[model samples]
Target: MSIFKTKSFWLATGMTLACSVAGVLLAKLPYVNLIGALVLALLLGIAMQVFPQQVRQTAQPGMAFISNKFLRLGIILLGFRLNLVTLARAGVKTILVAIIGVAGTICLTYWLSKKFGAEDELATLTACGCGICGAAAVMGVSPQIETNDEERKRENEVLAVAVVCVMGTVFTLLEIGLKPVLGLSAPQFGIVAGGSLHEIAHAVAAGGAFGESSLDNALIMKLSRVLLLAPVALIIGYWYQRKFVRRSVAQHQPTPKKLPIPWFLAGFILTSVLGTFLPLSAVVLDSFVQAAYIFLGMAMAALGISVNFRVIFQRGGAVFGAATISSACLLTYMVMMAKWFF
Candidate 1:
């Protein structure tokens, strides 16, 4: 029987659901949740190989849309967990470090991508995703760029997800190992991990590995980093449009109208601000946000399964190099700021 049959569909769906549940449950554990989620995500990726074609086709369009849309919405809801006033109390230095880390990561990654022989579009997507907020960053910029080839677009998506998974896992393991070995303070570890991890979830996991205080600090730092997404997207969009115009003029083709900014990003910012003033119950809001995040994770896992694992491994050195250099620079910057300012 073809793997695309009903059994395969149900099996894949079940596995995804299981992975999501495991991720959330693990997240609640004292120190193990982050590593658990990373392991589970990887296992799900490997299990996805059983029905390769089905997983790829399933992950293509719907998974992409679900991962992008709900993840943004989730980030908006996550704002409720934050106390803007408290963040302000943490002072401007914390904010400055976050801004520098985000900007530095993007610039460094772009330079590293060129050195690694990555395509421009892929490099841009990878850098933004790594620099700002993972998958959401990629989604925000996708509409602005014209990726006419579906295959190339798929390749971009795969690269983004693969990097996030690998880097997120490494961050978690590092947090787990370093917290005990170095006897680092919660705030110090939080600053280091939040600055380095590729995704917010990974930051949370790393923070949790250190304890509640570290988790709270790390989440705040990570959110501050996330706030950079809008400005970064705007700058990238502007630069992309400028390049497009130059190319069009050089080729004697009519320049297209500029693409509208992603409305969801604006909504995310607005909701975050509103969350500060709203009287909503934390239980209800937290539950909703948690659900959204779990769904986003499953969608990402499904997306991961779609990648050609062999191809990714073949190009592993370059990918690892880019991620390592970018993360290292960001981490170093954050640590220096934390020492100087905090």
Candidate 2:
């Protein structure tokens, strides 16, 4: 049967549209704007999972469509938002801050998760999600790592909530307490905020709350970390081969196919380059960005539909704990680096 004719497809599509719209409306509200549409979508998706089994069954295909298809498209379009000139204005120091901050978070989370004996796949997925761009990174990295389909689905469901909630918590605490607690100047805090936050939206919200100068610098720095996705994904692909593929080959088992560097990364680079040359109108760019965010929210909702709360609650605390600790360390690292180097 054609996917278009399936009830499941339509159900998922409706849910996607509904959740995305709801997320946007929520983001427009006072104070809630900082949490952004992505968080709202994640929450909305999780809430939907509480409905009767038939509803979720009917929505499965459409939710998968949103999670998989919509996700890749949004990641690619995000490239159009990157500008080399903006990155340049933020300076090399801002670039370093992005790189080191991301690296530190990933490394720290991985080590901590391993020490705690979490599953390897779960640890890596959580690390990438928190260290890079939240659910997008988790989804992108999922294919490259060694895992069964069942594990991937669970990771998607669990990480969707775990990662976003951590980011929101971090963003909140920073906004509420960082400046006064750390006694950092505005420009300094901008670098720290840009470098430390996991999601671009969180960073943008934190910086934008400050002022224009801090927002500009923070966003540019955040984009620099976004660009690192290509290299990091590539390295992860290679590492997956060494760790999983080699072992399977030696054992004469079915080996995993080498996942290529995601095509979306190429699109991102191309768009960023093109953006530096033939930039679109600010209004047009903003529209595209908003569209990307809404699509991502829809994808999160789709992913969330599959989550088993029983499974999530049983296994989520360790991963979120590692991420929270990593976030704290990253914030400290970013502040010290920004003060010392910049």
Number of the predicted model whose lDDT against the real structure is largest: 2
Model 1 gets an lDDT of 0.67
Tell me the tens digit of each residue's lDDT in model 1 across 1-342.
Answer: 543455545555565566667766766676555444534554565566676576557545544454455445554554455566767876787788878788888888878987898778777777887787666566555555565675556557667556756776776686567666655678878877777777777788778766888887887787777777777777777788888888999999998687557566676667666766777677766775676556555655655555555665555456557877887677667666656665
Residue-level lDDT of model 2, residues 1-342, one tens digit each, is 987788888888788778888988988886777666776887788788778998998788777767777877777777778888878876777777777777878889888877776777778877877777766677666656655576455654466447655665566566547677776667666777777776676777777777887777677767788878777877888887788877897999987766666776677678778767785888877777778777878887887777765666666666777877887787778778768875
lDDT of each: 0.67, 0.74
lDDT of 2: 0.74
Per-model TM against the reference: 0.80, 0.91
Q: Check candidate 2 and list the clashing pairs.
A: none
Candidate 1 residues lying further than 4 Å off, grouped into runs, are 1-32, 35-49, 52-82, 139-141, 175-184, 305-310
